[model samples]
Target: MRPLSTATLLCMSLIVPSLSQAEPRPANMVYLRTVDPTIEQDIRYATAHNFTGHPLDGYEAPQCLLSLDAAQALARVQASLKAQGYGLKVFDCYRPARAVADMGRFATQPGDPRKAEFYPRVDKQDFWHLGYVAKVSNHSRGNTVDLTLIGPQGLPADTWSPAASQADCAAPYGQRWHDGAVDMGTGFDCFDERAHTDSQAITATAQQNRERLTEALKKEGFVGYSKEWWHFTYAGDGAQKAVMDFPITAP
Candidate 1:
């Protein structure tokens, strides 16, 4: 809620100037740590939603867009979780605007069979109209994050099963163990109505799983998105800024 302190601001100024253009982080550094009730809240909500994915450990900067303030905010949220027996597990962070811009590289439509190997559900059809994702993500602002909650062990139950590969959020949890690394009822970025944060169409067990995540996230401040139950952004009182094109890369 409060703006970056004078001390943090000075530190950020020093760090930002020293970084340089480089390749994507080793699929690891993409996740950064930060504190925001929103992120915790998001994780709790995910547990309820039935997220089974693991938290990512780093982030990617937009090709050209950067937000040091947002990065600090994220670190704050991570710190808060460490205080409560939880650690922030990230998925994707600081998406480079260039990556977003390069969306065209894929099928102009998300459903183009050419890319079906990449996106299994829905199709190239929803990218623009359906809002599966966009050319300009607020994540480029460094103010958004993609993550899920871990258990007391700092790890979640193995949501994957032999059947996990075919499981959908709406499937019966009793009939099958949770699938995917996230605690949410479905997989991350799963494009389906059942993936909605709260969908009656899902089995009772799946619904309960989602509720678990929601309750936890609410305690923190991260609110869930109605469309994609697994997606939540730590949008505090910060101003909405321009999108960046910095790609996620590591040293």
Candidate 2:
């Protein structure tokens, strides 16, 4: 065979991905409902209810898919909360790597309809620098989750209004959209320092609710992100696993 020219080799390399460069497909992921039906789920990225104001890529259904280990840990957290007239309501879990890329793409675009509710204070271009959006998220590993607590009525006591006054993510509860989730200082995916897990700027009631959630997840081996009260990562082998690109299809 004749030796291929360097230019030809480079072109071929660009056209075909090497097997070594391909990410590994993970096994044993499960929908959260399979392990614990009591846990409530919003799965925001799968619906138009998220920061993007549109369904994200790779989320085919509104489902809380997660690594088995992470799901089980979440189940334990649910059990603990249930006894106290509270239940877990997850916003996101087991995000696909493609979805992370989608988030980055959306941030670059102009005209976000939901910006007032999710990121009113921070500009979209600053998302990466502010850690509001990431190129690589722990969620792709199927071990991270964004969640909150639901009250005994199984309803969010949100005081939602499109005309609600706009405030920074750190603004106290009623100032933002009445996101049905329990008042955790800010709305889900609220991109602000006020959303910081340990922020002392929130009301005493909101602070208590935030601590309650953190303590519940902590007992199950999950660690809350300092910047987002709703974000948690399972600290185990799952966190070290390869990021996934599987869609959240219905079982």
- In order of listing, the candidates' clash counts read 71, 1
Q: Report the C-alpha lDDT of model 2 over 63-98, residue by residue, as the tens digit.
A: 998888999889999999889988888889988888
RMSD of each: 12.7, 5.3
Per-model CA lDDT versus the true structure: 0.48, 0.81
| Model 2: residue 248 alpha-carbon error in angstroms | 1.2
User: Who wins the TM-score comparison?
Assistant: 2
Model 1 misses residue 52 by how many Å? 20
For residues 102-210, write the lDDT of model 1, one tens digit per residue: 4534436233322221234666655567776675676666656665555453223444332343444344433323322334555555666777776777657556656
Candidate 2 yields a Cα-based lDDT of 0.81
Clashes of 1: 71
Instruction: Give per-model TM-scores.
Output: 0.56, 0.83
